[model samples]
Target: MVIGRADLHTHTTASDGMQQPRENVRMAKEAGLAAVAITDHDTVEGIAEAMEAGEEFGITVVPGVEISTSAGGRDVHILGYYTNWQSDDWRGRLGSLTEVRDNRNLMIIEKLRSLGIPISLDEVLDEARKQGKDRGTIGRPHMASLLVAKGIVDTMQEAFDRYLAAGAAAYVNPPRLNPFEAVEWIRQAGGTSVIAHPGLYGDDDLVEEIIRSGAEGIEVFHSDHGTDDEVRYERLARQYGLIVTGGSDYHGERQGVVFHGTIGSRTVDAGVLKQLNPASR
Candidate 1:
């Protein structure tokens, strides 16, 4: 079958993305995407708006959330798709997680301030607002945007490499769930859990372990993955009978990583989507 256009990983104003849901959908349609998933960091609030916009733009919007979890002292992001959005259980879990995220962000800001960076929580929130991002639970990408606004660093990678990297002067680890717990929560919420950007983590064994712990898929086609890493991850997924997925991990201009439609070629197939949500089949 000919591959169709899809982007399983994307952000919007509901998280740290520069575009609003409507604008994102419009851009996706313009870019010739058949489907897209708004996998906002730690929140699914953008799904409804994305869905509405998708309907208007004649594209499919997959409900998704990127949950931050921990393993071996490193952060692992698990993408949850086709979740039960209205479930009280899901809301309670997300509320608790959001509180943890907010506290973590405040602590990071305090550390940055102590280092004489002069960044305030209000400044971060203001930056997010200026970018049309949600203010309730600001993320590092949003903070990095603030740094960019102040000319601290040219890009998000530089912001992290200079100050926010683990063991850096202003670095602090956030409270996080274990990988198993994160996958189980996604499963309980009636969503498929996929490991996001394994290439960034540099641990193929851990990816296999996550699949063993009920993660249904692996992100094999990420913008950051080199050709060899992509081939290796694809082989691993096939060896373990896991669904293969990919995306640009788009965060708009904040990261300066890649363009919105540049990574459109990497997409989860419709059969994989059906596997993610059997009802879709």
Candidate 2:
């Protein structure tokens, strides 16, 4: 089989991404992608819509989710691919995570309010509705859009840089699973767990620990990594015998970075997908 051009990581309205799933797929096809995955942060609500859109656009859609977990008191993201989205295990885990995320978002909102920014949950929800195109989950991107709408920031990056980023005034820590526990959960769900954007985390030892925990892959290529970093991650993946994956980590216009198919880019090889057997999940 021909190895199609694929981006295994991306987002949609289901999480912090700006576009709806259909729009993401349409853009991916226009960008000459043969396949794409809607690995939305902490949610799989958009995966079905993405798959439907991919069928029409002739881009194979991989079901995926970017799970937020904690390790050493820091947040780590794990990308789970090819799991049964509707399974009881998946639902249970997602429900628990959703509660954690919702609580975290509320805390962020309260922090912003205390800072005198005063963004209401209703306002955030309305902003999400405006961008959601009536599908998928609403998230931080929507809140950022509300900030933009209120003239708080010129762009999403500016919003994050000034407030939402770590160490920023509006930043708040969210509850999450530790890396080992996250890997175990993914394995239990019959999915492959991968460390997302290892370069950004800036800890090689942590990456090794994650691999030891049960992570089968590493996102060696990503929009966040520079050329040297990509090479380093590639070398690490090879050294650890890990499956390598890459993607744009597209969040739509909410992020000012390169488009969905534009960064540390390499297509997902067919062999890699074959290795992610759904039957194991």
Candidate 3:
């Protein structure tokens, strides 16, 4: 059922998403969503701009962040909603992640150079600036885009396929938070921690462990979810008594969904928002 008007997961140039903070808000309105979260990866820089745009566009902007953590040696994303963005602890936690990101960026560039890729961190940063992604934390995508610009690869996808993807020549595993630590950080900042895109993990045992890790909710509805995936996650939510959260996981064209199209793509029900942002409710 299309029970509510909230997309609790989305991104912007604040991290790796293609759209800007304000642009995503305006698009949320166009997509008929009453609320959208600015859950940029490891950064809250776009939250304020999104809230301001929400005011202008008549959309509710939920302050959120997607923390990248590792589980079973693989990357798992945790979505923190209704956070105290200004809290020192919150800011500090995210800031640390950015440091890790920066270090990883340097390492990745070094690896690329070792592979005779003829790339540099400065060139990647320049490409990111050209794409307006400089204001946010730089990531592998920026490096991939740089490869494209330098004609080292024809597209970001090609860059990933050949060198940057996991197990590729230039791939480097970076330091990241573990699931439990991430959940504790979110709860300490007075935010609800959620498991993002559980379908991608496909590990039922891992789902149970995440709940035990203190995750308050699971992303049961997502633009990437098929019917079976939704059903599976919905059952998991019910089994664990967890709040059912959903979102488009919008990342602009960089992802499968559009900036605004995600509103129509997934349904999270108004009740979930009430639980996530009781103050707003």
Candidate 4:
């Protein structure tokens, strides 16, 4: 069997990413990647279009989702691969999560307004629609774009630092699934679950707890992970007999800066894609 390179994490307009689903596939092909995963935040709506583009571009498109979960009062993201995304149950459960996300957005907007930022949810929705398809999920990135456009912030990072990021002034963490529950959800949906960007959580103990809770994989190489993080998680994956994975977590360029990193910037052998599927395991 021949193995190629695969960037197993990316986003599109179906979520907060600036690019369309087909555009991400095109970028992956242009980058010489044999495969890419459309792992949008809390939604698998982009997978259909990406899979179509993959056939046209001769690249493998992994159906994935970056599920937003909260654990120990931290924003922990769980990545699901090869999921039954077409299932009505899966879509309905995701809809509940979206409701939580929508409420969080409104609370953030209210907080920002109280802080005298002069923003509204309608403006954020409009910005989201303008940047991507109207069906895309409206997220903090869209709100940040509006903040920058309104001259409230010079860049998206500034907006995140000031308002969107955890511990920021306008930040809000609504009740959501724990990492363990997310892992089980992925299994119940006939997919594999991996701990995403573990280095960002600032709590290796909780990460280890999740690993012990039956997480099948660990994202050892990510756009934001440093050498130490890579080494640490690689060791953890080995210790726990977990599948090792890597990706760029590409979210597309915003304000002259690429969010996280560009596609194919960090990738692993395409063999990992097979390892990411429950059937293969």
Candidate 2 — which residues are off by over 4 angstroms?
Answer: 133-136, 255-266, 278-281
Q: Note the residue pairs that clash in candidate 2.
A: 14-137, 70-177, 190-281
Residue range 4-68, candidate 4, lDDT tens digits: 99998999998889899999999999999999999998898999999999999999999999999
TM-score against truth, every candidate: 0.92, 0.91, 0.92, 0.98
TM-score, prediction 4? 0.98
Q: Name the top lDDT candidate.
A: 4
The ten-residue window of minimal lDDT in model 2 covers 255-264
lDDT of 2 by residue, 1-281 (tens): 32667788988777777777888889878877777888987778898888899889887788889988877666788999987887877968887887887888888899888988979988888888776546545566667778889998898777777878777788877657787887888888888888998987868899899998779999987877889988898998899888898888887764455434441154566456766656632
* Pairs with backbone N, CA or C atoms under 3 Å apart (clashes), candidate 4: none
Model 1 Cα lDDT, one tens digit per residue, 108-139: 99988887888999898888888776533578
Models ranked on lDDT: 4, 3, 1, 2
User: After superposition, which runs of candidate 1 have C-alpha atoms over 4 Å from their true positions?
Assistant: 1-3, 134-136, 255-265
Residue 5, candidate 2: alpha-carbon lDDT = 72
Please list the C-alpha lDDT of all candidates, in the order they appear: 0.80, 0.79, 0.82, 0.92
Q: Candidate 3, residues 119-225: lDDT per residue as tens digits?
A: 88778778778777758798787787788778988876788889887778888777688888998989888889999988877676887898987998999888777
lDDT of 4 at 75: 95
Which one wins on TM-score?
Answer: 4
lDDT of model 4 at residue 265?
Answer: 96
- Model 1 poorest 10 in a row by lDDT: 254-263
Window of ten residues with lowest summed lDDT in model 4: 129-138
